[model samples]
Target: MNSTAKNCAALAKRLTDSGLRPTPQREVVFKVILEKRDHPTADEIFARVKSQMPTISLATVYNCLETLVQCGLVRQVNLERAPTRYCPNLHEHAHFHDDATGQVHDINLPADTLKQLRSLLPPGFDASTVELAFRGSKGSARAKLAEGRAAARSGAN
Candidate 1:
């Protein structure tokens, strides 16, 4: 099966395992996040779902999203301006938050990078998860910062 189908199946299995009743509203909310590439907030999701499920209340969507989050089927992209964004990509990765357009993009970091980073940690420290955010106006802030810092050091030398 394709990744999308697998994701949908996985989500269904999760809901079944979590003992959360699979109501129509819950299914719609799950599908909206699972299908969309753009990470949407709960309000955005409610607006989209309200078209087909006009009777479905906003509170229902909020509760369903929360339930999905708790079940680990959806990851919450918490930001200051937005209520909370949801992502179907559950793999280990970082996120980039655009300050100008307020977009959130997934960033995949190399495993060696994470390993090398952990090597520099103080003794007796154990790392579980690594989360890094590249925040900027429009461009890649992380790359820019690294390049700028490298240039500054070279110029000083």
Candidate 2:
């Protein structure tokens, strides 16, 4: 079978195993995540899915997303108090969050660094989960704005 078919089958199996009722709406959500690489937020996802599944409700999208997250098929990220974002990438990687544009990108860290960090932790502190996010504004616009703010603060001081 082709990659898309394989992904769909895998998602269906996962949902079934997780005791989630496999509905058409949920399947479409999974397909969107598998096809789109943007790592969309809930709103973004709802908009895209609605174009195809016109009858699908926003609440249904949210519920499907929550169910997918619970089934360990999707990762929900809340970067710096912004709206939560959903990612289909299951591997371990850091994230770069652009505060101005609200975009998130994945950054892979070295395995050795992860192991070393886990080793230095205190006893009884198991490092099963690792999430790192760098938040900043991208491009010259944000840079100029930040510089202006800094200048104003220094002048005030």
Candidate 3:
């Protein structure tokens, strides 16, 4: 189907799967996350969502984010002394943070490398999830943003 139809179906499934009530605020918040995919902090999300949903409060955004996280529809990414960023990727991967721009990028880990890393653990050491974050320069971060913007523009046309 069309992109809009696909997005609506996906959003509906997400709300139902997460046991969320699918309120308008939550729907807007989730749409912002899906549209941006830039790992936005709660403040940033609130700002973007405000233009579309003028009546939404920052507190409501935070509550929606918390509910999404608790329901397993999103993951929280934390860096040293940095505000928590929300990520919707539930796959086994890592995050690369650009110190200069405060940008977060998803780095997909090799399956074999992940397996080897898991093998290094001692006996009876159980880990539910593995997340790695690296801090570095603006390498490739700018390119990714440009690509996202280009795609968005094309989709809008």
Taken over the whole model, the C-alpha lDDT of each candidate is 0.82, 0.83, 0.83
- Deviation in Å, model 2, residue 86 alpha carbon: 26
Candidate 1 local lDDT, 1-157, one digit each (tens): 9875676677778888988676777778888887775999889999989987899888898899889889987888873555777899877778888888988898897788878888888999998876678887664678789888998989965
Task: For each candidate in turn, give its C-alpha RMSD to the true structure in angstroms.
Answer: 16.2, 15.3, 19.9
The clash number for model 3 is: 0
lDDT (Cα, 0-100) at 82 in candidate 1: 59
Q: Put down candidate 3 lDDT per residue, 89-155, tens digits, no spaces.
A: 9888888888788789999988898888888899999977766778887637688899889989899
How many Å off is the CA of 136 in candidate 3?
A: 28
- In candidate 2, stretches whose alpha carbon ends up further than 4 angstroms from where it belongs are 79-157
TM-score of each: 0.47, 0.50, 0.46
Q: Whose lDDT is higher: candidate 1's or candidate 3's? A: 3
Could you say which candidate leads in lDDT? 2
